[model samples]
Target: MGKPGFERAHHVAFFDAMATELPGDYDKQEVNHLTLSYFALGGLSLLRELDRVNKDEIARWVLSFQVHPEAHTDVDSGLFYGFCGSRSTQFPLSNVKDPCHNGSHLASTYSALAILKIVGYDLANVDSKALLQSMKKLQQPDGSFMPIHIGAETDLRFVYCAAAICSMLDDWTGMDKLKAKEYILNCQSYDGGFGMVPGSESHGGGTFCAVAALHLMGFIQVDLASNLNDSASIDMRMLLEWCLQRQVNDGGFQGRRNKASDTCYAFWVGGVLKIIGAYHLIDRCALREFLLTCQSPYGGFTKFPFDRIPDIYHSYYGLAALSLLEEEGLEPLSVELGILSSAL
Candidate 1:
């Protein structure tokens, strides 16, 4: 288990923001999408602040986004459409007032699904077969995945999303496993990490996605390890050594050598190490000081040291990184991680 890093004061303050049911100032315009909402709730749920909020109301709202199979335009298409935004924007206006049926996104689908699982909902309600069928359509021959429908941009992020979806549905037949695995393996740089695309600079976030996907798909051993002995080893000694060595005096983690660390990279690289079974290598005392300093006094968290513009995205990830370190009486998501790991 990871140890606590920062004080309880930070935890209580962050939890309070999550508990406050603020008016929907941003929901209609910006926060209406299920993906951002899911990221927000992920922070709250993983932090155990879900109890402080209305569980029934939130659960119902999340379930409402589920795309019933009947709504799909074609059975062969097997895609889910709809985005959850309130009545705010009149631009890109569709004939239908409701936004859910207008668009579909791979990122949104994965986040929406993850938020449901985080909230303890049963998977029985999900149309797994239809989702798998839709997933196959997005799979490119190169193994990268398009965002939702065909002709969308093919990239590493979508590849990770596709892998996560398959892992969640417990089916790989929907995707070309060999092609996807080959794509991930091909992206590995000379530095032994992955980039957003092949032959590009390595990034911690991209590395995490590639590694986590391979690990989830039962292919990490072959790619990350050298041989059978390395396959059985999950201690992450070597991997942690590489990741931890990337840390500077600050709490953040840098993707490349000698580069300054970013608050977000802390979670990406740190979270990856946690998955590799070596999160304990993080210096909790030092890292906590760095992360807490990044927190804005009004609420929310930021990147770098001593920055003030707090955002939901960085705030959520900052909390997650600290959770990995088990700081501030916060519990890590052992249950969810355990369930996902065992299934692989």
Candidate 2:
């Protein structure tokens, strides 16, 4: 592929291929299916590939999965289900018709926004006010938000989701800023990285979420400056350094220590490093090579080196990694490639 025959490929085709190949297996159930599709379709839109898809039909499909605006589900127990493929008529994912559905997930909400925005849909079709209200109602006393109605484990990731939602809406009324910041700061692991929860294992994804949230809040630079006396500032810098070193000889990044490198973690880790002003610390050429290697001849990118199968999650992340590197030939990509260029 000298230059991608991008004009010939389309979003619907990519997603149909993925949906057919990776069905609703136990490991990749309906919820994950929606998550991956959201990312893939949204990624395509940002790449100007939506011209090939049924934008209206795909938009309708996404709206079908939304919890009814009139349902007025409990903020505490009613988790926003990811997406339903005609599975059941449940108000929410957790308790509706079945109990094993897990619950509303923060990741799903995040993915949903990205996908919708990519397709050029505004907040009009969604119960924007109600969803914001629900988000506000779900804030915990500890500042960190939970992902489900019954409250699954509280963590930094949800904090990021909550913050991103607020950022997208251009409002912070839904979150307790002071306490949310406190919780995010508290979750910084000793390794100079942040984790899902306090004192948990440091992960590249969690670190990016936390860092991006803080940056979006306009507190990162000043806070980092003011916290010069605080131990957390050192932790922040150390986290940046750790992320910078994640690039292997092949140019991809790993999520945690000792794990094999993957294309997606490049964005999770590299994007954070970029925000922290440390992206240049890595060997850009090598990382670009690794990401390029993961790109399928068909247009999408795989999760790891030479993995045959490719999905939206990896495809978007791979594009994002290239975006960070600003590779010579490709167009620019968003930090989360799922957010369409039009949305920005």
Please name the candidate that would achieve the greatest lDDT relative to the true structure. Answer: 2
Residue range 1-344, candidate 1, lDDT tens digits: 34423444554555456445433554543534666566567666655666666666766776565444455357465344422232231123335565334345667667666766676666666767766776677777788987755255677887887777777767776678778878887777766666788888767877788767767777544322342246323333444566777677766678776888777877778766666555676776777777777776645677776787666667777777777666655556532232221122
- Residue 71, candidate 1: C-alpha displacement in angstroms: 7.6
Question: What is candidate 2's lDDT per residue for 60-152, written digit by digit as tens?
Answer: 766666654335555444444333333332354444566445344566667666666666677555665656666765668888887755566
* Candidate 2 local lDDT, residue 79: 44
Clash pairs for candidate 1: 5-327, 32-84, 82-100, 83-100
Candidate 2 achieves a global lDDT of: 0.66
Total residue pair clashes for candidate 1: 4
Q: Please list the residue runs of candidate 2 whose C-alpha ends up more than 4 Å from where it truly belongs after superposition.
A: 1-16, 19-27, 69-89, 92-104, 221-234, 297-299, 328-331, 336-338
Error of 2 at 196 (Å): 1.2
Pairs with steric clashes in candidate 2 = 76-149, 77-149, 79-104, 192-239, 251-286, 251-287
Per-model RMSD to reference: 5.3, 4.6
lDDT (Cα) of model 1 = 0.63
